[model samples]
Target: MSKFLLSALFGAAVALSSSAFAADQTLAEFHADMGGCESCHADGASASADGAFEFEQCQSCHGSLAEMDDKHKAHDGMMMCQDCHVTHEMNVGQKPTCDACHDDGRQ
Candidate 1:
């Protein structure tokens, strides 16, 4: 193959590889890459009295539970995004499990 073709292939491979590992990055790391805590929080880096501010920020980017698929719509108003997301304790692409709240074994 030509040098140019080899370089392009190498670049694509590297990009794909990086994405493969991005799912393992912490939520903090992923958000920091996009902007920072402020992207998900208000000024002073403190959560609002009822965490409404942070929740709004999340919906601003991720959409409301009602707007999501059936699984998410089911818990629309029953819980806050943080209740399951728990950014500090969750990874970027990790799906929250239902086993925590339901013992019947559901993902």
Candidate 2:
């Protein structure tokens, strides 16, 4: 292959690999990077007082709870996405646990 073609392929590969989780990036930071907090907020100015707008934004991107796996569907109508999936408090690859709410001691 030509040197130019090889370099282009290498660049594309690097871009795709970097699309995965960033070691120290929080979910909130990831979302903010996409289009700023406004991507999840109403106008990038502030979070909703009741979080209703932010909740809608989450659903718009990730789909509604009823559309997710059983772990998420189980909480449909009971809580907002932030209740368990705290992006601001969680890292990109981290997931929320029942311990955040449930106390049955099941790990």
Candidate 3:
């Protein structure tokens, strides 16, 4: 391929890669951008605390679900929220995934 053509192809590849990265958002930023989960998990039976149990606040206590603990080194943080506790509708015995997040007892 000619140098000019090669350069154009490389540039296009770089642009696409950068765009993909830009689309990715950090967990904290995701929650901040959403302006809290009250929209879906708010009011009546689905009411969540104003400041408590928000995704951001949960991260503070739970830490990222994908991190190292005493027993396990890698956990799936991406699915932590769904893995534990039912949001919007409370069940009588709903418990957070202690073992799933912790993988051991350290967390």
Candidate 4:
């Protein structure tokens, strides 16, 4: 009985380790498959209904770009738009400063 319990424990550990490794491998492959923002963001072919600029289509490559602060401010909740569309050149990969958008309070 003791031997059986030990074997089961070891088997469980091995299974867990294998699962973790598989997950890591998948993440690595995903990272490897990722391309630069310009790969899709640029060109008139990528334009959407929300104007010629958008980033929702970029979640697969760029992930999330929202921010939270001590004031409990969260852009994710307030705006469905991406920062690159309203503030900077999405394909150029240049991030704009806060003042760029907040200057006129239009953002």
lDDT of 1 by residue, 5-104 (tens): 4575577558757766577777766675655678777883766788888888788666899999988999999888888888777997688889879898
Q: What would the per-residue lDDT of candidate 3 be over residues 5-36, giving only the tens digit for each residue?
A: 45755775586567643334443333334434
Q: What is the overall TM-score of model 4 with all chains considered together?
A: 0.34
> What CA root-mean-square deviation does each model show from the true structure?
9.0, 8.2, 15.2, 14.1
Which lDDT tens digits does candidate 2 get at residues 24-107? 888788767655888787778777898899999888666899999998899899889988778788887677887877899754
Model 2's C-alpha root-mean-square deviation from the true structure amounts to 8.2
Clashing pairs in 4: none
Give candidate 2's error at residue 51 in angstroms. 0.5
Q: Global CA lDDT of candidate 4, please? A: 0.43
Please state the error at residue 33 of candidate 3 in Å.
25
lDDT of 1: 0.77
Off by over 4 Å in 1: 1-18
Q: Compared with the true structure, what per-residue lDDT tens digits does model 4 show for residues 1-107?
A: 35864575577557656764333233223222343334345552444566324455444334444543422244555554444244222322234345654776543
- Which should have the higher lDDT, number 2 or number 3? 2
TM-score of each: 0.73, 0.76, 0.26, 0.34
lDDT of 3 at 66: 54
lDDT of 3: 0.45
Off by over 4 Å in 4: 1-46, 51-54, 66-73, 80-93, 103-107
TM-score of candidate 3 versus the correct structure, residues matched by position:
0.26
